[model samples]
Target: MGIEWAEPGSSGHVLEASMRPVDSLQHSRATPVRARMWKFSLPLRHPETGRLFADIDHLGAGLQRRSIDRYMWLIHDRDEGSAPHVQGALRLSNSRTSTQLSSILGLPSTALRPLRDRSGQHGAFERYCRYLLHESPEAQADGKFHYPDSAVHANFRFRDMIDRYFGLADSGCVPTAESADQIRLKVYNGDMTPLEVHGRHPMIFIRNHKSIEELYYKGRHDRLIAAALAERAALKDEDARVPSTDPHAA
Candidate 1:
């Protein structure tokens, strides 16, 4: 409810994830030798009835939208946490209808032009209407997904959030340590401090929305920038580890 949307996996911040800030994770305490845990059970009192009817039919996939919580719970039996959902969450807004649907989805509209601008992860974009009209919920139904509009428009802004959340930066296209050290050395030799250096990076700017300490992740650009800077600094450190080639010594 804090940041959850009225619809499942719809537009809005994920409530669960927001509650626990990433900064706190870095300073988590070690587990206790033994901690007391308790369990409790509550009984649900319903009206007098011989049996309860299962709503399996009402549960299957159709066009029913609920808050992300109810939806993730239905799929994984656990919460996937919440994400920020802005107005861009809904692509069908009356005013934004004219906006390029492809851009919103983070894909070039012309990229699939030969196919008539058709899109569907599992093939639903063009066939969406067809599915709704012909495919009954019972006979055959498919699910369609779209990225948050903010990502398409302001991807750089959420770079930190995306990288940390997905853990892709560490293993994926990262700059070498030498590169990181070089960046750090450059920043140090320049007229800027660490804080200033971070400020200048595109990634930092994106994550440093309201405050630098408590930054909100907008996308992956931040990770890329940070990695590059880090690699430069690491490079400089490597160079320093060995003695400089001295003409007077062997």
Candidate 2:
């Protein structure tokens, strides 16, 4: 069963879903979680800087500490030259209703949208991951896979965290059809090829020279490579001053 949305009213958006007990037997099955996933989007601003919220790491950690089972946050501008906003999905393991979850997140009820997957399809979490990362078949066919510079804050590590939480393993065995599908969903939306996606983890690929050049420097690969090399040399020089036995030595 999936979430059913209430009709719009003066009360704003209200999420309604049938609650299901945590099925222990499902753990042995291929499906991920029995819990439903809710997507949230809200504008957050830094009071001092007048920019987007910049402490997503702290926000994510706080949510996890509050017993949120799994979550992923993506910060991006709403439009060209517009202020950035935060959007993501979360899975609740407890009995808290959607209203309660919104309260805990300091967001109005309208911000939450319950995700529903088609019959015999991937779980809601996987669906949201593909949609947000622009890896879904629909997104690919439409050529709508693009994110702004603010998308640099997109947390790919959370995908790995969610996989681990669900006990999904990435064994280095030969790729099956299922494994190939998983790789497609996990590939970055940037200019990376399948070979590159297979070679590096998503987290590392996000911050590597190629991604930095394409995302931030507008594909100035040569300039970016030179800067990266210079920075590495400077870091080595700084490391030489540290004693080998020092715990802080790089």
Candidate 3:
């Protein structure tokens, strides 16, 4: 006898088999993302010296994203009306968790410090930073600053490595007149180069509201925010409904 195959739509058994795989898949779904926690040591400057430094044990969680640049002379001068006065600003620098920068650059951390105050169009720091990447290193030892282009985000990663051990010089309103003068000597007139700023306030990734907000898209952000609030309210309602276990009183 010749084998007779059922028409595609006529076979209930075939459809059931097809849905079995999907049904099995539904039971093994992944868990939703959980909030991340982090820690960071609170840093402060010496009231007198304005020297900045942080010990090893600081960590904070935030959705890791590149911070926006700010604190330019132009921004300070323009009156933006309602924009919040520049309460503060953050500067990013390249750093290396790898020894690649150190091995290639030869200059390492110590050499970079002396040139930290580069500004006024011809600062030693920028020159050295660019120079090392080009002149030294492995196969491209002669390339010099080859990575500074958009591909490497300049020396940001290398700069981040330097971020590990850094110092700070306070420039904004000071606690006293003497301290203010010290800042003037140590810090630029709110024009400190990005390197100096980075050492002062090392990049932090904190898992605060901003981190959560950023993870969602523009429209989704609002919806998620409202949903989270509602979920929290429902939890509170559930807590209120739980019966107390005071059997003796009853």
Candidate 4:
């Protein structure tokens, strides 16, 4: 048997096959499974009123009922003229075929892209979690910090899900509150490494691209910095040679 549902702005039909209840799949210990990670952007919030367009809890519950392995999500506030939206990552379990996964999620197969790390340095899921939690240096430099308590509606559930899925035993690495000036001092004085700074303050880090670049390739940061300086000098010389745009100027 199959069930069909229509989604707004979707032209193709969606069919979900009747499968065995997902509850039967749960066990005392979560089995090692081939997990697929996905990122989704949903129009499930109001831009102006800061209201949710749909019941987020209900949506999460539905996903849980459908046997999703784990997820972490947040409602992003409108920024720089963009509308507010819900952004999230989904980890699907049970080794279901991609087609079945698409059917379960009620999304077109084309839209269900599995996240992967192109650089092969880290797992896509881990990198994405770091990005979303503002743990990555890039995210820290971007200055768009997302606090789990304020940004995520189901923060507790998300934490529990992550801990369970990763088998993480809390190391008591809670961040201590620090003023901006204090953070700046700690980061700039070479008192601590980038990872150490991140451990203490996951949401804020002074832009230290060199430290990040050094992690992957020792001494590459200096070469890249020199190359950038050369490029800037060349651009300045090019600009100097250009004819003046002002008609009244000498």
lDDT of each: 0.28, 0.49, 0.27, 0.49
lDDT of 4 at 81: 35
Root-mean-square deviation per candidate: 23.3, 14.5, 28.5, 16.4
What is candidate 4's lDDT per residue for 117-151, written digit by digit as tens? 67744456655654555534455566655444356
- lDDT for each residue of candidate 3 in 35-66, tens digit (9 for 90 to 100): 11111111122223443322112111111233
TM-score of each: 0.15, 0.43, 0.16, 0.41
User: What's model 2's TM-score?
Assistant: 0.43
lDDT agreement of model 4 with the native? 0.49
Q: How would you encode candidate 2's per-residue C-alpha lDDT over 1-250 as one tens digit per residue?
A: 1222232212222232333224323423533323356776655553234544334554565465445766766764433433455677776666455566654666544456676666876566765654565533355466644453245333345444333322332333332232232444344333545456535443233223344334433434555777899999999999988669967856
Question: What is the C-alpha lDDT profile of model 1 across 1-250, one tens digit per residue?
Answer: 1111123233222233255566335423422221111111111111133122112223222103221111110121111332222111121212222113323323221111111223533322222222212222222233333222232322122323332322222233332222223334444344334465354443322322233322223223465678899999999999889897889876
Question: In model 2, where do residues sit more than 4 Å from their true spots?
Answer: 1-35, 44-62, 78-84, 140-156, 159-250
Q: Residue 70 of model 3: what lDDT?
A: 13
